[model samples]
Target: MSDEKESVVGASLISEDRNGVRTLTLHRPQRKNAIDRALWVALRDALDAAGHDPAVRVLVITGAGGAFCSGADIAEPDPTHPVDKMRRLTDVALLLHELPIPTIAKVNGVAVGAGWNLALGCDLVVATPESRFSQIFARRGLSVDLGGSWLLPKLVGLQQAKRLALLTEMIDAEQARALNLVTWVVPESEVDEFVLELAARLVAGPPVALAQTKALLNEGADRTLRDALASEARAQAVNFATADAAEAFAAFAEKRDPEFTGRWSVSGRAVPL
Candidate 1:
């Protein structure tokens, strides 16, 4: 796709598309990109759009100005019922988690509370050295939301998850990387370019196969070994039915780079990834 940019929900969120990557930027820099109600709705809409867009091979979530998200905008008084308000967060979280394409969280600065879980929801997280993270819910007298309760323990064992949740201690990038919360910690100056290149690499991959691989891994944790193998076999069957798989073999034989179109072999149509 050609470069395109649009502001959503009173410019509280910015959506940009470059090549095959769609970036959703939290745009409330004045509030350190804290997700207010408008932003929550905007984000949900953006993720839903990207998930359905065939041109979007990768999705990147980041913040504007300096900091990443600081969690929900609790300071902004909302007369909306608490449960209804939380439903917005749940929508964004589930949409992000269930998105078919690969996702990356480009953490520029602080990512706390629901913000931190937002990054955790992505397939990969690339943070700067100066970035700080915390599960600040405990300190705010709120328990984890935005899938933190489920994601944290899976990323770092149950004990570590408890320690981070209960203590609400701020951790640096290196420390977060040590806990496997971050995939890479690039320098502040290089992080943007690094993520761009990474996203480009993902964009070049076979879209349907990549989507299936992501699904397998996401669901594998809860499945038995035999079930996992069965799923993998099913996935490979689907992959082989795609033109990209045949293109891969042809490219290998020809000693050339494979161009993955993710087209169905029989119908000559794009796979419904």
Candidate 2:
């Protein structure tokens, strides 16, 4: 796709598309990109749109100016009930986690509370050396939301998760990386280019197979070994039915790069790769 850009939801969010990658930027730098109710709604809609868009092979989440996100905007007053307000966060988290395309969190600065969990929800996280992270909910008299309760322990183990959540200590990029919370720590100057190249690599991959691999790994943790193997077998059977799989073999024999279309071999139907 040609490069395209637009500011949406009263400019609280910016959506930019380049090649097959869509980058969603949290735009409230004045407030450290905090998710006010409007931004929360905008983000949910943006994620939903990207998930259904065939042209979007990869999704990147980042923030404008400096901070990634400061979590929900508790400072902003709203008449909406507490439970209803929280449902907004739930929608964004579930949509992000269930996205078929590969996702990358480009953490430019502080990612705190639900903001940190938002980054964690992505498949990969690329943070700058200067970036900081915290599960600051306890400090703010709030419990973890936005899947932090489930994702934190899985990433850093129960003890570490509790320590981070309870203590609310801010950590640097290297510290987060050591705990496997970040996939890579890059220089601020190089982070944008690095993520762009990373997204390009994912875009070039077979979309169908990558989605299956991601799903298998995400669900494998909760499944028995035998069940996991059965799922893998079923996934491979579906992969073989795609034109991309045949193209891969042909390209390997021809010593050429495979052009993946994510099309069905039998019906010629495409899966929006």
The TM-score between candidate 1 and the true structure equals: 0.95
lDDT of 1 by residue, 1-273 (tens): 366655564578888888989989999999999998888989999999999999899999999889999999999988999899989999999999999999999999999999999999999999999899999998889999999999989999999999999999999999999999999999998998999999999999999999999999999988999999999999988897899987887798899999998998854544332
lDDT of each: 0.92, 0.93
Off by over 4 Å in 2: 267-273
Task: Give the lowest summed-lDDT range of ten residues in model 2.
Answer: 264-273
Best by lDDT: 2
RMSD of 2: 3.1
